[model samples]
Target chain A: MASGGSGWRTLPPGGIIVEPGSSLRYKTGTWRVMRPIINQDKCVRCRMCWVYCPDAAIIETDEEYVDSKGRRWNRTYKVNYDYCKGCGICAEECPVNAIEMVPEVK
Target chain B: MMGSQPERFKSKFRGILDIPREERFVSGHRLCAGCPVGTVMRMLTKVAGKDSIIVNGTGCLEVSSTPYPYTSWMNPWIHVAFENTGAVASGVEAALKVLKAKGVLGKDVKVVAVAGDGGTFDIGLQSLSGMLERGHKVMYVLYDNEAYMNTGIQRSGATPWGAWTTTTPVGKKWKGEWRWKKDIMGIVLAHRVPYAATASPSHPMDMIRKFEKALYYTREGPTFVHVLIPCTTGWRFDPALSIKVARLAVETGIWVLYEVEKGKFRVTHKVRKRKPVREYLKLQGRFRHLTDDDIEYIQKIVDEEVDRINKMAGEEVIGPVEA
Candidate 1:
């Protein structure tokens, strides 16, 4: 494990960082102007939003829920607002018109 | 249960959650909204998998992802200077090979070097050429944003002609970028590497197939993939129109999708009814200053290039060769 060092003399070969996933502290969701609202009623649990999201903001949760139509769903999807940049790619890629990009109120 | 062949050919990625969640490049990085570079990075990382080490050059991808203490990479990653990504990857590959030969490392690992066009086409050409000639078992991917977007949109070697950049501004004396984009794929083919291809983020499956092919060629020698990534800020387009702009680039024959293996040329994605170049150029603000004559000039060039590629692929010439 290497710490912050001054020059190239103390750096590892090829500047390889031994630690991975060090970006957890940086919150990138503040850059979003639009947020995606997933309509569970229209969502077929198809995971289309999960795949097309460039930011990896869509998370698949094991906890199931019932939609407004009283339809039972197995797995649910949630947008990780802490990192989603709201590119609207998820909304555009949704085949069933489930995800809608609405202006961020806050 | 038997199904129709068309049903079998459906997208494998429809069940998106079924795709592996173990990401090599995670979120929270600072790439711009609707930046195709991020999408290309994600797709490449997904295809490369966990048994790989990524070597990134100093550019948008490097500066945005690894800001000092914070890094978005989940796999073993390295950040080298602009000109030496290929060199660094070569060193890493050598080290891994030595460790494996000594029985210290059990599993096989792949080395992938990623760089923007400014790093690859302009600054990093020497090291990239050397690495290719040396036949190192590394995959070099150049995400061609066509400009130095990280340092505020300057004209790069990969920038197409008549496109506005900070350096090549549209003025009375001169139109935006009077020169044509350099033929990087031709240069890579000149190296006579095992695999080389042109890809775009618009076609993910084609890009993924090329990535997998590059991975396969890692056992043979070096593999190079040039990807066209549309930049929303640099290209001066709506953020939502990124994918559409990229798709139009291919449809208009401006960026032909093709691959070269062992000196044989093949057109991967054929455009049946090629759209005119104006249709693609009209979408971006960068080409707003172009006159009808300028547009015609561009169309002529594109058509000639398409004819050349079709001839190489042994496909019937679809576009007019003579302007």
Candidate 2:
């Protein structure tokens, strides 16, 4: 077993796995400093943030959210902080100014 | 109501960032922080979309992303030797063509070949030229960082004159590299490919437009894109200044942004009032040892090149070339 007990000995010599998406095990969330907060009311469901996120941290959701302004939204976007590197490219590219980067509490 | 909008309008009207997230290159790769290559790769992959195959040459991008145990590419990627990216891409394109003809591949898949300047301008030139001559449907991208950074900042054929590298160190009698940078765009264009362009990571919008144009031209023949990727470590500049340095390269006319489609030249980002070359040269440590005469020499050459490109773009020269 390797350090994380994934049974490395069971694998081939180079730990080669003839598969894809195995990099998902490496969590990169610790790279974040400022987190993106999406304002659903202002969002036009444009998916701009989702597109520009270099880390692919932005996920589209069918679930709706009521903003502080009491506006309801049928579809929204969520930032998967697990992989977001706080690049702020999403906030910079959001056409409607719906995404804001706030200081990470932790 | 928004959903009711025409799909064509939605697709066309959306900004570069408004496109759907189809990331083929994921994070957690080991590219340096604030590295322009990462951004360039991300944006290029986004433009390439999911239905694309990437052929990478042995360079920083390759060595960093794919270690033995892990790989960052979500799309089908093939890693080739430093000098054979273009040859491999041709084979992949040929295979895809056969698959499509035999009804094995039901969808259209784009082929992209990526390499650094060392691979494209020097070692891989033969393969690249062959691929272009053969008219493979591959979009070849050369991320020109000047020197071979991955191999300890050695001087390469693409290293500009008066730039310092390990192999071309500044000595008492000798000053850095004594030769001008190779005109790779000219060499690539000589193949008579349908489309080719020079791009920089600093201008994201321009890069996106150029990539889209290159992809469009892939249907006709092969296309080539040369990107000036600023090397923070090798160039001895702060990592954060990578984009700024790249922008300065364009503003000073050192890196002219232009595209040639079907043998016609057009300057994509025309600088109405170009800055002096020294404004760009002084920022990097590679040019720290340059003398006044050297600076003047560089300025003169840059001005001449800018004039030539502007003339091709059919723009009137506003003022005399200044040193």
Candidate 3:
């Protein structure tokens, strides 16, 4: 609301509330809270964000976070939107940057 | 002492807010009584929490944390030498990748690298640049007390123009450092890392929220957070005035908090009205030697920097729509 630019079109209330992947828009970049989006294809399941997120935002089972081979991953990670503060930690700490912050529709 | 009364405690608190019961940094470690880095670290850990991999450079935080098999860190932490924490965090990310692949790590683990002004603006600049260039998913926090406080308060790149340091002292013939505070945040932004920000202990919530955003940039690759951690020892300010001095830094526009993403710039916190930089400088003993003319010059620099950032933030830049 604080002059966050005219081009920022508000999304319909019920539009899918996804994380604002790496592309966050706010006056301070600090003010921008992002949601996490896990790309299964690229995810290595490091779970760094799970351990690092100030708010416990990541969710994923160790079993589910496996590659093509039937091998368990080093860590399983996913974003829990309910508790996730939209802190980009999960996205920032992802070994592969697999987790991204996608914009959430208000 | 910050007594038990809540309102009185909060109002009297300096630099930033502290959420009791949340001991991110934990207790029982030693830092200098008036160390600026310690205060800033408290704020960062409070916001970053236990679910973070805190990579610290061999500075005050690292020294205090790793006192021969003891650590104050409540979070999963590591300490590499002075010039490579940024690089080491990159490797930590790589390891987490393998561990995550093996189903042994959590998605919530955030990676953060904390360094002093010397490490960030001078010695570690190259490694930080490399991390940014490669787009590593880490939040590199520069706790700037201006000079190299960890190493006897020598001058570093972050030392302000005409400020005194053991290395850059004022004399009858020469002023202090005699150069500008390197625009480290500005340099970080030029790399086009997904997120780059400047914060101060003055606004605890703001600083916390910034780290929140930094944590969320998982896919964006590389984020830099520069926090203005005022020094009581190095800057020669009263320990009690630390927070007040930090507030003055921003209020006077001597230290601006703004961010740039995809080349667009904007002011994160604006002081509707400007205050004289003199008021801010007058509080610090470091700048006590500054003549009115020197203060005027510094004031002009602050004003110009503010104006430039405001202009950039005003520009319109389109971003991806919410999925």
Candidate 4:
């Protein structure tokens, strides 16, 4: 149960989950010692990082991108730090080497 | 024709970049950092969408995704016992059918039952068989992490030959699991199921397409999709290498990706020149202890299976095995 909530007494009959996606309240951001940062200039918007992320932490942003070759990408990827455990699968799987795993300063 | 209405697009995956962005299997609860089961569930729910009820069997997917007071599932979900997931999913599918006929329920509700290899290949085989034989409209997905991971990597029937687990420890006299991995797809196919496919999270586009077909198409008996979920902690690999290892399994001949529909087998991801199984085996600590002879034995078994599957397809879907 989350903070300031009644314990077992207020639970649904037989403890059926009434609220969907209740796990959002429990943040897993602190679990990582390293964090992945995407290089905007280098990202080609291939979405390799987004598609390969096991945690679903890679978020597609409506940001504009233009590579050195004059190719344009309307959307790019960013990491959702709240749920990212820094597995670095995105970095490892990126075809362009756009993602880099940096030490979590905190 | 100018005034005509345009054709509506279904929820089909157009390409790798195109996918449903709905967060059905939301982040949280707790799964291992690089567990492909997470990716599997995410992609599955995305394909199945919101008008679905998920029946999860007891295993790591259940233990990690649905701890007390929270759940990673946004869709209607029920936690079934290890041995009765098929029964529950069948019941749910039946109930939905009756309710819809009686006008008690509205809209189409899809039923998807998910379980790890332990629950499906071993403990819950009977109920699963019953579900298939009865022809329920439930979609069954086997997330094969290759062992009972959450309870500490005990060997399951799905554990590969010569692979280490707590129960199948490497020793002087005893090797890893001696028995070959259970042929679940064959068993599923024997039920005369309409659509069944083997997939891996490494190939997300292909995986999602199979999930889509299993969830939406295939008009008859229960659909089964067996997916290999490479584990991080259990496999003892760098968490980031999860997808890479899964891809390697496909590139090598150890795990073949194919779909069998209406008794017809078709290879989905065909490797042109198959790599040696050692390239895949050497990465995971589970297969670290296999001797050269043992590795050769495994390779021989893979080559034989590939040839057999190739013969079944009547073409070289997978390339000839490499030495």
Tens-digit lDDT string for candidate 4 (A19-97): 8998888888789878999988888788778777777788988878887778888997889899999998998999989
- What local lDDT score does residue B218 receive in model 2, on the 0 to 100 scale? 86
Ranked by lDDT from best down, the candidates are 4, 1, 2, 3
Q: If ranked by TM-score, best first, what sequence of candidates would result? A: 4, 1, 2, 3
**C-alpha RMSD for every candidate:** 5.8, 6.8, 21.7, 4.4
lDDT of 4 by residue, B164-280 (tens): 999999999889899989899989988888789999999999899899888754345699999998899888899999999999999997888998766778898988899999899
Which model scores highest in TM-score?
A: 4
What's model 2's lDDT at B199?
Answer: 97
- Residue B319's lDDT in candidate 1: 48
Preferred candidate (lDDT higher): 3 or 4: 4
Best by DockQ: 4
What lDDT score goes with residue B150 in model 3?
72
DockQ of each: 0.50, 0.23, 0.01, 0.74
Q: State which candidate, 2 or 4, has the greater lDDT.
A: 4
Model 4 clash pairs?
A: none
Question: In angstroms, how far off is A26's CA in candidate 4?
Answer: 1.2
A21-72 in candidate 3: lDDT tens per residue?
1111111222235556887767765434443433323444535445666665
Docking quality tier of model 1:
medium
In model 2, which regions exceed 4 Å deviation? A1-17, A27-106, B1-14, B317-323
- The alpha-carbon lDDT assigned to residue A96 of candidate 4 equals 89
DockQ score for candidate 3:
0.01
